[model samples]
Target: MRHSFYCFALFSLLGAAALLGQDKTPPAKLVLKAKTGNVTYDHAAHAKREKNACPVCHPKLFTQDAKAPVAFKPPHKKHEDAKASCGSCHRAGGTAFETKGNCTNSKCHVKATERKG
Candidate 1:
């Protein structure tokens, strides 16, 4: 009984420490797909770009669910003006570069072909 009590106490302390060590940031990366190619958005880089402003995207541009279904339709103009849409900022002189600027640039995106081969 004494051994079991000690084990329980040790586990409790370990769990608490583990929780405390966790970061408050949601995640540093997310994979977004488009008809042209797949791109991994680096939240860490964007956080720096936005000067660590979470409100730039939270609850407005994106929900808490990182795995939410984001349909990237073509005829791209259709989505250019949609509320909180990626293109809203991905366009020229917004915040980030245009999506079609270059598929090889590592700053914004990496093509699936490049990611694999």
Candidate 2:
């Protein structure tokens, strides 16, 4: 009976560790479709920029689920002033670049050309 208890305890500990490890692993990228074009958000790069601190944007600015809406709609000034969504950092004088003149041309939105067969 003692031997069985020890085995069960060890398995429980290992299972807990594995579950904890999964939360630390963020998705590499998330593609958000836009009217102009699709924006490929580099999750790994952003996480690296934040030193892998998940809380920096989780459960507040954004959620852990990628399928959820980003809530970064137009009339961006509203979100920017409120420091919400991507505007939290991409606004003018924010940590990252602003969205004013960076709409297209290798910026956030890039229209892809179709290839003819």
Candidate 3:
């Protein structure tokens, strides 16, 4: 009985460890609505750029919840000056390109082309 109990306990601990080792998958893309156009955020690409370091943005620059608002509204200089939201990196002289000249041509705000079916 003692040996059987030890084996059961060991297996239970191993099972828990296995489950904990799995990483929570993030969304592939997130479409944010805007008056000018919708922004398609490439989550996978960002994750890859960051080398899958989730803490770089999660619960800090942005939340883990996809449904949450990005809080990046226009007259964007406010957020850019503060280094908040997307402005944290996209600001002038920041890590990513600034949003000024690249608004429509960039991958950020995309005007939807009509689909013919």
Candidate 4:
């Protein structure tokens, strides 16, 4: 009985410390699927930049509105398009979210180099 009591106290202290040490900001991005690209919208950064409340992206990308519990992992199973109802053009010819811009240049997520087959 005494051993269990001590264990409980230790667990409580650890839990409190973990909570205190956490950042007030939401930990991660509000990832959404779009036809152009699988968008990893940094919620913390976006909130800071836009100065908006949590509801702006909550219940969807943000965890504050989680209908189901989520962990530090990808939320959806399918690609961005089908999940969000974004048509194929979002990834292709000339809709909106094409990867043609930043991907091709050194700016955004440009690949290191092309390898020959």
Candidate 5:
């Protein structure tokens, strides 16, 4: 019984850890699928980026087909040139509020050879 109790405690701790680390970021499926490059943009993590503001940048690069208010539409979209879309600004990178790397030189962008990987 003690072993079972320990297991439950361990799981609870892990659960809490996951929640703490979880990117509060909502689903970015719309923008994710629309991207043209192999770049993986973590919207949640990005939101946490200090100087980055979603409203300030998103609409300029992306377009709404329905002509409805963004609040009335889902946060993401599907199937389009993501780079030519939202990626345009993000491609250049931005100032970090709580993280590292310049917005333009960010890992998501960086001229091919400039990438850290």
Candidate 6:
């Protein structure tokens, strides 16, 4: 009976450790599609870059739903006037590059190459 109790405690501890490990795991990238292109967002990378400040954007700039509809419609505007879109960051003097004149940059856009038959 004592050996069984020890085994149960060991298993419980292991289970708890596994759960804790998941809490630190990085989140998968979220893809936001636009008429001109798609934006791949690595929440984990951004969180790490921001030192894991979830409250900085949670329920405020962005919601918990990674698939939530962005505040703007597409075609990728040239100006950064939409506060609830990717422009929130990809604007002039923003945390990221400006989307106005830098739309074709590889970091913000993945240009499609011509396909051969």
- The true-versus-predicted C-alpha distance at residue 9 of model 4, in Å, is 0.6
lDDT of 2 by residue, 1-117 (tens): 999999999999999999987765567999899998888899999999999888999988998998889988887788889999999998999999888888786768878899999
Off by over 4 Å in 5: 1-25, 28-37, 50-52, 63-106, 109-117
- Point out where model 1 deviates above 4 Å: 1-24, 103-109, 113-117
Q: Tell me each candidate's TM-score.
A: 0.59, 0.80, 0.76, 0.32, 0.28, 0.60
Model 2 residue runs over 4 Å out of place are 1-24
Best by TM-score: 2
lDDT, model 2: 0.88
True-vs-predicted CA distance for residue 75, candidate 5, Å: 27
Assess each prediction's global lDDT (C-alpha) against the native. Answer: 0.69, 0.88, 0.90, 0.47, 0.43, 0.70
Give per-residue lDDT, candidate 5, residue 75.
Answer: 27
The residue pairs in collision within model 2 are none
Report the C-alpha lDDT of model 1 over 1-117, residue by residue, as the tens digit: 999999999999999999999776677889887655567877788778889888887767677677886544564455555633676686555566665655557754455553655
| Ranking of models by TM-score | 2, 3, 6, 1, 4, 5
Expressed as tens digits, the lDDT of each residue in 1-117 for candidate 4 is 999999999999999999999766554665443333444545465567547765544544435642333322222223333433222223444344544344434322333356999
RMSD of 4: 9.2
How does candidate 5 score on lDDT? 0.43
Q: Cα RMSD (Å) between model 3 and the true structure?
A: 3.9
TM-score of 3: 0.76
Candidate 4, after superposition: displacement of residue 17 in Å? 0.5
Candidate 1's C-alpha lDDT? 0.69
